[model samples]
Target: MSKLSTYVHVPMENRITVTLLCCASFVCIESLRKNWRPALTHLSNGLRIIESLPMSMLNKLRDTVSIYGSANNTEEELGMDYILRLFATWEVSCALFAENFKPVISVKLYRGRELDDKPLDEFESITQAHRAIVQYTRDIFALVWLFRDHQGDDQFWSQPIPRRQHEILSHRGDCMGGLFERFMAKPQAPPSGTGEHYSLQWLPPTVYPNLIASLGIEGRFKLWAEDPSAAPGRRFSASNRATTSKAAYEMRSAKYPYRSFSMKHNEETRHTYLALLASDGRLMVFENEQPENMSEYTPIDELSICTKPSRGEEVSFKVRFDPNPDPCYNAMQAGVANDSLALVVAGMAAVKIYRSRDVITTSYGVAQTQREFYLALEVGVHRGLVRDVAWAPGNIRGHDIIATACQDGFVRVFRIDTPHSSNEGKSWSTSELPRYENHQVQTCSRAGQLNDKQQHQSGLSASLAKSGSHAERHFSGQLGQVKHACKEIAKLDSHRTPVWRVGFDDDGQILASTGDDGKLVCYRQTPSGDWAKSSELAIVKTRMATP
Candidate 1:
């Protein structure tokens, strides 16, 4: 048994309304036999949940599994982790997949060409370049609609077309038209120079293969694929054995290099995006590819799925952080903002910040994301790894506050007090490494940006980097690696064990940090605007072993 809340006060059979609203709804027309109460109840319950601005039910559930995952916590010791995921995933996932029910607002994709008038039956063939997908959040409850090819009906699983009915009609080898297998092959990078253009519309993509896996059955069209009857002429895989084929999807959904932390919900504007950081030293940005949603800036509450999406070249929004000077990190953290928004990502020993070129006047503002990234600071906390980073909300104050958790058993607060540069298309200068002794202090400043003279020197160094292993071996044997540090406003060394996470609520008023001690410490801003310890929550209760 676990801690659970019974939030649904009304019975599933109760209707939301039976009067004037019925004229516009099909449910009202069909109200003769079926009880629309459950659906309405869900609608009411969902709004209540969204008011708190929580992560997607899917991500929150994933968070629990993350805490107890093989690489993180033990199931026996962290039984609590299963509680939240179990309840949330069951409720939301069930409603999402419920017969005739929808959770996603819609998903539209860009294939880099004019699309066929009819909705696509399946993903663009392995040969076509599939570049982006748009996600729209509907104003209604949890349900969402999707049109993969930008020219279809609202329904995803069926109605407009059921492509999943037979994605793989024939079997040739180990893969039955495994679309994901092809995804592993690096598609040519989006044609260069289009960098700034695409950056204006979307964020840097994450490792796509793993993201596909996380989509579950919906990802690779497994809904009907698993059913032998769905495709009568084709034979199912041997392991599929009469509808017990979850193994196909289970094997595909392994850990993504950059897992999601949080995303602005549909109630938020289309410009708000999904923020993720990779353990492998990359920041991934995802935004709706909607052409129409691109034009509006509705408050979070009024925002919903776009009724239409387009297949045009001149669409999207963006940013860029120079390839890592050292590019190594144990974990990562990221935060997103609105109105001339600012994005900050940090990990290992580095912290990078990106700003929109200007505030968006319209509803959708992904276009504001710039390819130019400001290397705000480099952090080196006693040569320790950073566990987490967070930004406090304040357009008035311009998001200067940051909180970070570190392996050094401390939670640090940092302020972005510098006028950083826009280092677009600039690779960190590897040529000047040997010129300085304290690499941390040496490479962490604005001087690191490459000007004309430095660019020439960088060319020689970059040439060496591109040169074969022999050149790398020669350079490695001669010059050493550089270290860097970003300044912090304050450091709180309260935890005895390594601090694992740190964050600020939407308001800059409260700050919280969690650690291996199984305790959560919270700090609140004072009347005078100073953060002070306010509360401590015990995650793992002191318990005796059972027989």
Candidate 2:
């Protein structure tokens, strides 16, 4: 084996010798167990040599022999099938756990149309278990490649898994799950008459956890189906104006070319807010009446997402409404309320988060809502174009995690820890006015018997004048209130291709991504509080021989 490692780069004409060396190296590595490091080196070298050979030659060799030599088979043909199986095992083993290893041998030897084109049961030559392991691992390798190629693809990750890819991941995951179930459900030993023998439940060994972790690919199909974003967002078209014909609001601005727009609904206020991304790098915010009533939209405030005008025309932006508002905002003048929300915008290679506070200004004899979005955190990783940005749901951790898929083929996660503030425990009271119904406006403490000056000061006059007026609040005011400390918790480049889309699981625990490479990769936070790669799946396309 030691000598074979040195001669791994030998001429390709010596295929038989190379194959024998690879089989021997793999056998030695398994037998030596504790002292397998040197054997592994030999195996890696020999496998690389075999991987470099043409698929045609390997196929010819495989077809000439069976698992056991037949009467018609010559000495050269004996054990060829077993040798190929050894190569396949090594390829999968390297991909799952080995360092800096890829599955070149498997790809070269696979005669199927594509790993994802068939279910495990469709394979005829191998046992069900063997078939599942081989096909799934190879499919995962293809998935990783796809993920790398399409790292910046939004549709791949955010939307429903493509039909072909979906079938592959789903089928493989089911196969693996069944295998585990069968293994655990093995028949128990027959009870002895004399002694009471309990049927012990079968459990996988501890080493299986690491191996089973890769089975996450099986659940990905179900996860994608459960994702809210799996269904495409409602589309609005000006040409076919039946649904959106009645304009909620229109900003006739030739001066500021609106690059993109995002809308977020506040459950507390039951009002929808619109954010228009201006090419000038500023965001224009507008307030709407209610969820059902969308006929009117009033311009509220505008803020900058970027310090300077971005040269790139492509922009991606999303808005998130924080459930908890800073208790400090609850004290802003009686009857006036503040809302906490955040705007994440990306252009070029930069992603900026703006913490916004919608302040209900009750001045000029009318109550109105105004928003102020301040730049809170910025991530300027030298990664290429920022393709997509996702803000995970639920803030149980008392912080926000923003995931970005960049053209440089990295899915980076940033953690923003801000002060923990809530308006849950606080209470508000109402006072009656002569002309209007008793308005229960959100106030700090001043309850009853207010003079005219106090009425205007407490914003009771505006509440009295307007019908169904409420505050749309987001990130509190004071520039320093927003956390500037953005920690990059994870920077994953396993895809090795431009990532186009990123999305979070419901609980914000798992993050999945897809790229132009046609692969999907998932990451999850471990109990140790570190983000690690969980699983991978890919759409493998293969070339057919010309008829």
Candidate 3:
């Protein structure tokens, strides 16, 4: 393979520029071919090729972009300050990646680190245990840099995983390198009372403060999702819509947009979706390009997602599932089935869904038009509004199982399946989907009531022994090609306050949720279809230091 790598040289404190360069440039490596020189690839039309970079170093410049330009813009306080603070630790991440790809340090990078007072340590591990912790520390620290919500929310990067309520870091955040030392039980204790500026986490295992300093082309797109400017503020309301504009609140801008929130794709279908929870109780769906055939789903691409419609019109979906839509609803979570026929929406109201023959797609097994989606099933989970919803992939138990986070501070589970009719996930079980004769929805829980106007048309059916007439049985199946859309599985008083999000991981066996208490609880599915809360992780907020 011809060499396509480039090298970047920066002599001063402009680490951000280095990061920008990292994204825009490629690390130029010498061609391994003995006789042939490889071609250099440029990004867009106006990128001046800085040819004739001294290629004396062999694998020395591997896995990096050689940036050879000067900056034209100045950094601002309100604008770049947030990013500066967040990415303050990113230079370390760059170094790690650089060491992975190329061991030799560049002269410019070496000098800049000495000036910054972040001297380097030998990039070697003492023990496998410390090494594992070091790896996790690197990953989570990077996640904090890219995904944390605000600068002042310092706890995200270093907060302790508190086991007791009293230990919650509600008062002050933890130090960066403190956790690693504690976990590793290093020979010497971390400093006792000094508060000097330190990149504890970024410094350990030999500092590469500017290692792989760029987000790269792919990472540049990833940055769009976590841009600090568009992050949601604390005080949100319906009339006072989220500060994000339609253009700014885009998929490219907000994919995995929230701090520590998980985004899922349909496991079984070619159709892909990214759901964003707007501050004022709204759900936005960004889908990948429509597929060419039933057996094919176009691979989701950053550019291919539909953000604008043909007429340049935008749609704002109502969160009717909010127990009360009168005020601004806190839309929490949304999910789609692998088969692509069912959708589950959860927030500060009843749990709502869009379940139809192809509610999300057209008759041709293509992407569904926005107009085709309507509330097919909406059920009240808690007396207060619901917070999150997660749908498991298809199940052999024959139902669309779902989990919910609620404002009432409960994490509940529900199953939406029809036993009488084949209202199961065989939505497209194979190349040729098998169709089951639509039967009456045998039962709607005694307390659960449908909220959609379409619900009056749809009815729930009872068991064969409890049925009165064919009409009553027919009415229960009114959800248009769906039956038994929701039945309460178990409503655990999971948290004392509101539960923020609930979801089943990819496997569909384990469920997880995060709450206002700043704790993450994972529940596993027993062989008998029962859910038991398993483990918990604390991600608490910084509590003010006591005066």
Cα lDDT tens digits, model 3, 336-413, are 222333345554465666532222222232222221234446676466656556667536444557777776788888
Candidates ranked by TM-score, best first? Answer: 2, 3, 1
Residue range 234-309, candidate 2, lDDT tens digits: 2221121214332323343456555555555554455656666655556667776544334466665565555454
TM-score of 3: 0.34
Residue 354 in candidate 1, Cα distance off native in Å: 2.7
TM-score, each model? Answer: 0.33, 0.43, 0.34
Q: List the candidate numbers ranked by lDDT, top first.
A: 2, 3, 1
lDDT for model 2:
0.54
Q: Per-residue lDDT for 236 in model 1?
A: 28
Tens digits of per-residue lDDT, candidate 1, 1-547, equal: 0011224343322222221122223333343335666544544354333334334432333221234325444434244234332333333444554554334311111111112232222333332323111110111122223332434544554542334322211121113235334444445433221211101111213311111112122111121122334465333231322234322211121342332223332332323344434333333444434421221222211110111223321111111221122122110111111122345555453444543221111112111111212223444453355656676665245326667777678787765543323431223344332222343343333233323223222433433343333222211211121112335656676677778777776566788998978888998766754567889988564644546
lDDT, model 3, position 403:
78
Clashes of each: 29, 32, 42
